[model samples]
Target chain A: MTIEALGQVNVTESPTAGSRSVDCFEKLEQIGEGTYGQVYMAKEIETGEVVALKKIRMDNEREGFPITAIREIKILKKLHHENVIKLKEIVTSDGPEKDEQGRPGKSSIHGNKYKGGIYMVFEYMDHDLTGLADRPGMRFTVPQIKCYMRQLLTGLHYCHVNQVLHRDIKGSNLLIDNEGNVKLADFGLARSFSNDQNANLTNRVITLWYRPPELLLGTTKYGPAVDMWSVGCIFAELLQGKPIFPGKDEPEQLNKIYELCGAPDEVNWPGVSKIPYYNKFKPTRQMKRRLREVFRHFDRHALELLEKMLTLDPAQRITAKDALDAEYFWTDPLPCDPKSLPKYESSHEFQTKKKRQQRQNEEMAKRQKMQHPRLPPIQQPGQHAQMRSGPNQTIHSQPQVAAGPTHHYGKPRGRGAPYGSNNMSGGGPRGSGSSGGGYGVGAPNYPQQGGPYGGSTAGRGSNMMGGNRNQQQYGWQQ
Target chain B: MAANFWTSSHYKHLLDQEDVDMVNPLDKEKGITLEDFKLIKMHMANYILKLAQQVKVRQRVVATAVTYMRRVYTKKSMTEYDPRLVAPTCLYLASKAEESTVQARLLVFYIKKLYADDKYRYEIKDILEMEMKVLEALNYYLVVYHPYRSLSPLLQDAGLNDLNMTQLTWGLVNDTYKMDLILVHPPHLIALACIYIASVLREKDTTAWFEELRVDMNVVKNISMEILDFYESNRMFTEERINAALQKLTLRP
Candidate 1:
């Protein structure tokens, strides 16, 4: 969709009854909950312009903004790509986000007047990529897939060149506007790459299902190529109507990949044996199956490109730029124009209900645990502290608290930022050859030909993958 | 920070007249130039240090307070907000942003006990209110990249690190910040010459050390000149100038 179509979401002027009348966005029902806050649809009080208001809930003023929220805000504030979401204004949220002065948060960056509930005013988006793909009447032709592939790549390439990696590159993370434009949305995992030559410090959390093999195998220090691999998975899913690799876990996931691409012998992918978990998994000889076997309905060219993208070695995987450049995108029939792509604003009641239920469930669970059963005793603050690796790769393994999925914020942070240099296993993609032989975080170099517990076969695939360091993304958010 | 003229907030607000300049000291009836405030700001860096240091806050927080003091001056003349009120307010906001919370009572107690000044009467609570205003004025772009982070390395790269060079370099950084060296010269140059001067003062005589180095000699010269002029103008070894600026500034109650 053209960037101009962002306004389609606010076609009807409805402001929530609670909104100040001066704002005049006739409130519609709630849209999706924002990544870290509440969201509602409203029309411009003056020009009748419609927009989405996201009220950010930063629990503690002393602790400051959530890092994920900060990451999203800082990136969104500066990014102006056609395929990116735009922040119109940052109003402090009204309901519960007021500060000691009782001022609604005008903006997260700005204090006081915009305090209480920090509101992020965004240009309206009609639907998300998941919804567009799931539209009951929608059917994607090969050409259309190519078109999306191109747009997705264009956006990803833009992100990469700007040193920002949209690590969570999945269908749901891509928002479709009223026109057919698909803009990249969530940036919680995005980070600026160093201006220096190192590229391995960035790739930690692309979603599983769409995650690259290097990530699945455990190469934390990988680069933009991991994102490219996801684009490949998403591209295939766009054509297949389901996840290309729906592995129950990382091992199964790798088996699914090997079934199509065949076992790694270091010929196709050079650094197989050197990976940290290389000795763990034994890739069984299941007579490699073809992509056609897995996705028999896809066109030959689509299968071919999928094969290139789904390559185990990220270094050899087809790039978003290259995929956009492929014959599959350009030949036989051209993809439909972005504007002509189908548009349907499905009722968001289900998503809204799910979010509300999740929040309720979390709160209830918290209360119940507190009131009844012997709760996990609240340990002192340092109980959860894991030793982090220091500057010299001297393993500290600082237990990192799991990053939030619950928008529960902590104290506004102060002086000490966690040291950027801390890395458990060189912080590279776990098993991909970059594993820390420096610290022996990997399994022994000798490949184990059997299961982790005795000879209970799942054969080679089970050994090397998920044997240890099960910290990979596995794309298991679901 | 590097000379990010195109990108720094300083460049964005330098000549613009959109903001409320609380310290309209330029005497609008007499009509003054932004250049005048800019220079005075350079001078005020010394003043802020004396005050901030008196309260025992981190130099980082002090620098932020000083930068806000400078930023506020860009739009408003110095005469608008009493610099005394503005200074403490900037310090308060800087403390919050820097994650160093000083209790208002303790803050007021220190201020009142330190100088015993009857003018600019303020309790800790009033300082907190002014902090919000300063935060609003600066727009919370608080990821300040100071020259200090870049200076030490610059001094070392100049082949200046010798016995006790690190200590002298730090002292130079601490003392240089008392003036507008930050406003005019980049950080590394100041770090280098301070090391040079320390070498000279110690009779280590490393004059030849600079001859072979390649850099903007003017920026280096500019920084040292600032330090020298500041030292000559103020008795930094004592708190005389701070006491003077405080008394002459006619602070608000």
Candidate 2:
């Protein structure tokens, strides 16, 4: 819709004098939830244009509006590119007196009733990278992967050039519309940086799986190389059909990086030992670099670019601009046009995970009937599995699954079964509890434990991952 | 856009002098003249600075907060937005947007501490509520380009990076917030105007430097004149006059 139409909608539907009310649009469904609040798919009442309405969570905020929301809105306003999510406008609603659960919100700190709600309106997109990649029997052609990677690099290049560090690049933050265009989303952790590199930024950012080695090593002084490391991780995930590194916590996460990218020493990364966490989490065993060996099947040029992106040294990490000029994008079977890729029904990580859970429950029910012919069908699917497996056993089974790299692509080996079985006994509660802090915090109401790939599989699709990591420490806890 | 001045929201939404100077109909109906409106905004800007000092935020955050307040007044009335509430709310929102992040409770504490009058004191709810209105009035275009970002580079380019001259030029850019120069002019032009003023004051020979830069000298001269006019007019703006102008505002219940 045009800007003039938006203005008219504001004037006609505004109940108050100052700003456009949320009455201008109709909320369709709760598509995703983030660290701040719920994200809804809404349609503008006047133009019938679909948009994403991200509620700015304010009910429990003693600090007024959330700082993350403010940063997201401010950064999104400054960014305008075909490859970046568009923040259309901000609309207000009167008296979010009732919280999302339809209960009266906790009394405001000042003992006054909750007054207003803010929703950041953004252009809608169909799929996120994690959701698309997790689709059963879905495999991206080489050209298609190139297309998404190129768009991601271009958008990232724009952000870096604009002096803004996205700080939270992951598969799910890459939103793809029906026409196959990928735009960067979720700038809540984003901040503008200067070329001087003197400022001390928070080292706790990016998802655990995608966080660069420097950030994991507790380096506060960083630049665009941090994002480039994430882009490298994403490129490898796209080619390998799964996450390259899925660590459960900080020490394990750093260990996983050492296993794959090799250990960072003074020779490869000068000043590596000077980082705050170097002595604490230092690897005991020397590990060899295995990017080429692990991803040998990948195209040679793609491997070359990944190697540069996954370099142990942050100083040697390839930039988005330089990565775009990499030969992988220019060689045979080049990156296809975004419009040429095929489209599918709207698939968000939340919806797909729900569908997978439901399907798994049905399959478990069928197995229960076949195994116990005389017993009545268990009413609570989550409880029956727990009753059989026992909680401790179920919990033990998960770490093994998480530790190994089980390639689930061509082999249809009981996808989601291990995770579905742990639903009540182990996975469900742990998943919900982990959402409280740290990098890769799952979205509210979604489980963080995924099928045999740690939390990086089905549950990693929401843009809410990689939330406020301030509560998480980088070094070994004493 | 944060890096590029020409393509920023600040550039796209640069208001004409007439647009920036127009008094809101609501304020005009409340018997607030054009001069009264400008005086109230100037007073609120100072109020924001004082509050920001109490909150211990950077001057950049204070400048951004003042810019937000000014942008709100251009599209809204002080009567509807409540200058007492909007001023602190702008600082609150700008602190978060600029990544400094002062707590709302801290702001409420200082507001109650700074102002004893019932009309000036506001609760957390009032400031939080006014923050939403200000964000809406701004259309969520929160990124602001300031002359401060351009001042140092321009000073270096003009070979005028001496301590006294640099501080004076920086102070000049800070004072430009008291006028409508931010809304009516690009930041670099404003920085150039500050440099021009500082060069004249410090007796620095930068005429050759400015001419070589190949910019519209007339616009720079006009901005310089406007800054001079603001200083001349506000020289006698004491506490009593600020109170009289603010008291004239018909605030919302």
Candidate 3:
């Protein structure tokens, strides 16, 4: 039942007014990370209820409380829905200060000085839509997709009815549990909007991929239709294995959208040309709305709903209420009950690992560019030089073999060899030396040191040895 | 949720007269009578209004702050923490809750200006320290639904949008914050009582509108009498009289 029905007739006095503190919970393993802080899996010590604890990072925030957190807490405190993540309460851990060995250290001296150890307690969920979709062998059936979409719309309807905008609704922001209950989470960006102040809202919201065209073209006066556009994208993504339109940047994102949904014009989107970025870049002529052609497997009812949701005009877009009342939901093979959906361990760990690996690879490539300046730029097959010619050049690109006096000379390893063998030798001193030289101080030292061992066979060998050492040091650095 | 007061926290957490007394039992031991409490609250509400003005916030924010202060006192006793401190802290929290967002420094500065006398003055840290206590006392139910929200819609429905009557009704609604009417009664009834009082003062005929509302006429009559009692006390007890009553009561910070 709903809180309203109970609130009306019953005079059930609340047992207590304030939130119970963190002593009621015991911290567990880290589950996920949010934009501002880390989320951990925790357990209610007394009730044995599993919960998600989001630690609010309060480093250097001289302002008493972050407005983002305050807004989120205030909004979440009032919101209660099965499909919306319930914020149980704000609990403070203010733990005893610990030494490096994890023993409690100095309880009275300075332990209580640190203030921000507060955590937002929420109902624990096993999976998010992104993690579910990205699982290696997982494929959502039509009924399952329908079930998830219904829940999404229901949650959105509740928020919109309550005058709140879930400004950042995307696949990842939609969390799910083992029972397949999809809930809207991460309300850090959500805000309660009033009708009188709709025009002055910020446009820089929602993920770029799921952002609506109106927001992209900078319309602060937009409404619930903005969230509807994201719903359409999520729906399309659910039908297809991949995102329907995965644009790399803002301009390209808009282009990718126009290519699929067809270009907006006066007839389709009145006053479309008036948006600030409309004339800056011209998209090709309409491809005639390929949503039907792209998702030919979708039934007629589903396609009709998708078309209404992806409507170019904000005025024409389907609202969450209308979407909930769509004929598609009432058709054959109706949405599966949330509790009946198949259960699986969340694969969020694998997704996080994949992203971390991708990031490490990019970092290694950057370090390679900085270390091997003498090595000619190896361009990929179809790439142009201008693509790699950005302003982020490392100043440590120049070759320098300085500080020979301080160098504990070791056997020279083969040039361009792997880093492990190089580290076995005395490459540490050379690594530090060249890094110092790369900053220009070692450049002058190289010439001054080159004089002491010059004009001899040993000196020439030392030069080659120094060059090899530099390469080995750069390799070891990676 | 702001538009739906019935389902909001205000209705769900409505307290009776006994419940309010149970929350603050210590006030009875301190010899603070119910009349003296009303006068103290009215003065503090004025102080909150002045502080909100210095920060240039809307009346909605001030009203929310006053409601928060009143709710806090319902759970805490005046002798435990000075109203002088809790009053400004409520405004500080309410400003943020209502989205007006006055900076802590600005709030403290304005508060210092409002209470220039040493007996009532406070530092910025004092207000900040009292904020958490006030929040805890309120049980984090920051959302407050005031009768002012009902005043506009009810007036429009009644076709009684006369300027003088509206202004009088609004002021009377503001004064209701000093009474336990917010704690014990629903916002619409309080609004209806304000309208009834204003109608009687202006000699305007709103009996048909009241009858059409279908609300309990007895409840409306009771709420109006409560406000009239405050007005009677306001005329009878001057500031000196209220101060003498306050002196008899023991208070602590």
Leading candidate by DockQ: 2
The prediction achieving the highest TM-score against the true structure is 2
lDDT of 2 by residue, A1-478 (tens): 1111111110111123555678899989777754456778999999999998877756656666666666777777666788999988777776544677889755555543324567888899998776676565567899999999999999998888778898878876889999999999888767888889888887766766678889888888889999999999888777765565656556766887887778889999999999998898887877877667766667899989999999989888889989999999999899998889988888766555555555445544565567742232232333322222112222222332221111100011112222332333334323334223121222122212232233333223211223232222112110
lDDT at residue A350 of model 2 (Cα atoms): 55
* lDDT tens per residue, model 3, A86-137: 8887776455535338787444221223243557889888877765665544
lDDT tens per residue, model 2, B1-253: 3344443344555677787788888777777878888888898889999999999999999988998888888788777788888999999999877777777888989988998988888887788767766776776667777788878988998888889988999999989988877777877799999999988887889889998997899999999999998988877888887777777774433
Each candidate: RMSD to true structure? 15.1, 8.8, 15.0
- Candidate 2 clashing pairs? none
What tens-digit string does per-residue lDDT give for candidate 1 at B146-221? 5566556655665656657767767777776555444344444666667666766676656566767665667576
DockQ each: 0.03, 0.36, 0.26
Q: Which model, 2 or 3, shows the larger TM-score? A: 2
Backbone clashes in each candidate structure, one number apiece? 77, 0, 0
Candidate 2: segments with Cα more than 4 A from true spot: A1-17, A95-116, A372-478, B1-12, B250-253
The C-alpha lDDT values of all candidates are 0.52, 0.70, 0.65
Docking class of 3: acceptable
Scored against the true structure, residue A176 in model 1 reaches a CA lDDT of 67
Ranking by lDDT: 2, 3, 1
